[model samples]
Target: MSDIFNTSIIFKSSIFATPVYGPTTIGNMLWFFIILVLAVIIAKIVSLNLNRFLKDRVRKNDLNLITKAAYWLIFSIGFLTALPNLHVDLSGILVAGGIVGIIIGFAAQSVVANLISGIFLIFEQPLKIGDNVLIEDTLIIVEDIRIFSTIGKTFEGIYVRIPNEKIFTTTITNYVANTARRFEYAVEIRYQDDAARAIQIIEALIEDEPFCLKKPGPSVFVDELAADGVIIKTRIWAPSEVWWDIRTTMLWKIKCALEKDGMEIPFPQRTIWVNLDDGDSTPKKTIPERNHVAEVRIHTCKPSHPALEKSHPNSITAYNGPDESDKE
Candidate 1:
């Protein structure tokens, strides 16, 4: 054992000795290899645990990048620590590395900013992959989270790559982050329709739908009584995962149900009273405004006096003039 341990592989080499391990020999190489292997084993174990811990918390691509970086960082520390045993000097390398690091830092400011932002995102977790989010007024589904950027697909099927820094700094509206979400509908029913009946129908429909949450109970009430119709505001809480579907489908369902129950959405309308007593057939009330102009016919006009008709035989009896309210 002594003969094997005492044998020299590199003849006439400078003796590299440490206080604890005595003079270095060819066996130092063995120790270096052993230390390196131990480092790899430790790094692997740490990375595995980290990946498992972050499996649910972080995005897949981000986790991969994190684990790889952790593995290399641990291995590098072990490599540097072990180098001394092999009689390698690190002072010059560290100096050179410092200079290079400063240069890289200056040149890659945005990259470093993104990396830091990515790290913050991994821990903060404001949004995740598959979450529907509105960032900077653009609504999208998060497709992937990377170290430098995030990939998203818009509702229009356009793919967008957003910088991590932008994502971190901007306001993120994650629609599905919470378990439950609320949506509202402003339904205008005919002014003549029964508001109480409309509310009952809406409440019943919400109760029948499974997606609508019951604890925070739905609200159905007449919000406003406008000139055209009664505005029934309906608010409901549902699971965030199905909120959009419920919002789109439930509105139509509510409309159909109301229509079936003899309720109709009212449009703007007016009943004008003409002053037939006067010579000019001026309306006492203006007609309602609509996209298409409607012809107004005075259904009931007073008969002219026989004496006046005889006196003005060739004169214009009634003049239909435009509305004078605006002019006044």
Candidate 2:
């Protein structure tokens, strides 16, 4: 037992005096390694805790980046603290690192901008995952938000990747951001049909639909008396989640109800009159449906003038308007 203790002491003295690199001895190197190992373990534990804390607060990609950055930051601090034990000059390394950092910053200007913008987006939260948003005229459902870019799927099923800088700078229209939304429709009915009745029918239909919100209610009134028909404007408020379905379904139901009540949409009509060579001043009216050509023919009229009766009693006059085709 005495020999073993003496041998251990001798080994320790030799290790402490042995030079490994520069003025650093084996003992210093061992201490450096021990510090590094401890740093790694501490970094891992801190990162794990940070990840757990931020798991639900931030996006998946953002959480991952934040945890990794934190881990590396702690490890780097530990490494720098343990580096002086080797008796190395850190000033030269710091100067070199500063130069490299400047060079990298200049080289990755856009990348840095995107990263900064992404950080702002995380806090601002203009649009979240699964939000129906329109960014720069491209409508999409946000799938994931990352440090530098955002991933989404368009309504047409096309995948899109948008940079965080652009997303942060541009305007975004989030459809479902509000609890309720409003949609309007300009329904046309025949001029002969009752406008008040049409409005009532639309109001009734809106009342029947459960998705339509009752707080804001609905507005149905005669908006315009157009040439073709009476335009009944209907503005309805509904829950944002089911507003689209209500809009589509309600319009069809309104049409069916109006049609069932003997209300039909009317086509444009114009009246035309032709003067006769005789003393008759009565006018001829012609009403034609849309897309149909009108046939015009003059009828023989009994002449009251005595001189025209001898000259040409069979003479007739006819006037017709040009074919009118309306494109909806």
Candidate 3:
């Protein structure tokens, strides 16, 4: 046991005396720490300069990425230079690291894809922080953009975390990208009401709104003639910030104005007709009864105009007279 102890003490002393590149024993370790400190300081300086240089060229979202990359690059060079001084073989370590990296790459392929997409997003600047956007049918306000994911606050006041890969591939509607937005509505009025008068009323209503833009002007026209009424279409442009407010309020205002003008918004209307004997002086069918019951046939026809009949030969016209059988 004494001999083994003596051998261990000799081995340790030999190691302590041997020079590892430069200073031996504890001195070399202290120097290594000092070199690391210097590396940190140099990395910080490089990062600061890189940030300053890219301040104008790059977007604010990419500033952090650029500085982080600069710092890591400088730090890695310093680490590699100091690594040889440690007197340890690094070939095996490098090989093992490569193998581990390959395994991780296969295991976390999606994570890597998200990271790459995040980088593209920061550079492209399709959306910035605090922008209102619609993604996957959800309207949200962007909060923070990270390397792997983006965070958003939904209109419902909930936080949503979307992977950068998904965001990059999906369609994003940026509502605030443009200064102005358009809104349209179809106002229905009775066929008896004058369409020209209705249009004039709507134009006046739109002109009165402060948010509505005048240069482009508002459009009010008869768009369609339906079975029940005429559809008056109104289209107007407004600032994006006030688009929602204007859209919600203008409709009610128009409704009130039209009603005050005695214009009626019509509902579905249908007309029916019945045939009776006028010569009998009683409400009874003229046709002969078969087996103690009168045989009667009914026909339906849609009311049409001369203009419509000229355009559509097959269109059914209004009932003109009773059928030949009833006449007989």
Candidate 4:
């Protein structure tokens, strides 16, 4: 093994040694630094030129992206170019990098997954900045599309940072992805109410609303026959931005219009029947054990106890205990 190792080292040195020109290796080192500095300066100058040239059309965010990418690219190339000066073989370094990367990958598999997911998201473009979206039913606006995560502002004015992996895997409901969206609602009316008139009233209310889209007009119909009342379904198309306003305003408008049209909104109700001949409501009278050995039974119940009855206020007796003996 030692002979094999020694022979390989000797062979490697001979192959890569090449020829050290001029003085010591210091010249190569110094030259590498000079090239590195020049690269950095050129990268910055080019980035500044782009900024000034597109000053009118470019936003601060765009400029930041341009500058950042340029800086990193320049720095990376400069570092790689300096490798030969340090007497390091590129092939060896690449192989070593591969091995190290594999080892670290086992330790950070999740991180790699997230990075790949983020990359795919940038290209998919399911949602964009300045758009309102519901991710996992949590409503938020796309504040920014970043490299590793998505930044958002919730309806409650809270800032949210969601990982790219979660965003990619979870359902993304982009409200503003399309110009027109269907808003749905159900209005319940009493059984005695006029169904046709109720539908017409809701349709008219939606049509008059300016935010509602005209192409689709508005739709209203009896969608369901519910237990307490009939459910009137209404669906209307509206611009995504004004959806919340239209939804809230339409509710009040529909209810008011129905009332004005003399249509009743059903309330929860029930029916009950009482029978007097079955002895259900009437009570039996019982006298204390007294003269003439009077035998009787009284069924008295507590205010909340349902079927339990007692012979006396504080004394509990079977519901049929004394009543059966009295009959006999």
Best by TM-score: 1
Tens digits of lDDT, candidate 2, 31-112 = 7887899899999999999999999998665677688888899899889889887887889888998998789889998998
Which ten residues in a row are the worst by lDDT in model 4?
290-299
Ranking of candidates on TM-score, top first: 1, 2, 4, 3
User: For candidate 1, what's the RMSD?
Assistant: 9.0
lDDT of each: 0.80, 0.81, 0.77, 0.73
In terms of TM-score, which candidate is stronger, 2 or 4?
Answer: 2
Tens-digit lDDT string for candidate 4 (1-328)? 9998985566456434444654325456665787789888878887788778877886554565667678778878887877577678789989999999998789988787777887788768787787888889678888877777889999889999888888899999898889878888899997778899888778778778888888877788899989768999998898887887888888888898998887767655432132324556754443333221212123222222333333334444434433554466
- Candidate 2 overall lDDT versus native: 0.81
* Candidate achieving higher lDDT, 3 or 4: 3
- Pairing residues by index, what is the TM-score of model 1? 0.66
Cα lDDT of model 3 by residue, 125-171, tens digit: 78888789998887899888888999999988999999999999999
Q: Estimate each model's TM-score.
A: 0.66, 0.65, 0.59, 0.60
Which candidate has the top score in lDDT? Answer: 2
For model 1, the local distance difference test gives 0.80
Q: Put down candidate 1 lDDT per residue, 1-328, tens digits, no spaces.
A: 7665555432234542223344555557666887899899999999999999999998675687789889989999889878877766688778998999889889999998998898898778888888999999889999887878989999999999999999999999999999999999999997668999999999999999999999799999999988778999999999999998999999999999999999988755545544555676664564534432133222112234343355544332332443364256
Error of 2 at 270 (Å): 3.8
Superior by lDDT: candidate 1 or candidate 4: 1
Q: Give candidate 3's TM-score.
A: 0.59
- Candidate 2 has its poorest 10 consecutive residues by lDDT at 293-302
lDDT of 2 at 302: 22
Clash count per candidate: 0, 0, 0, 0
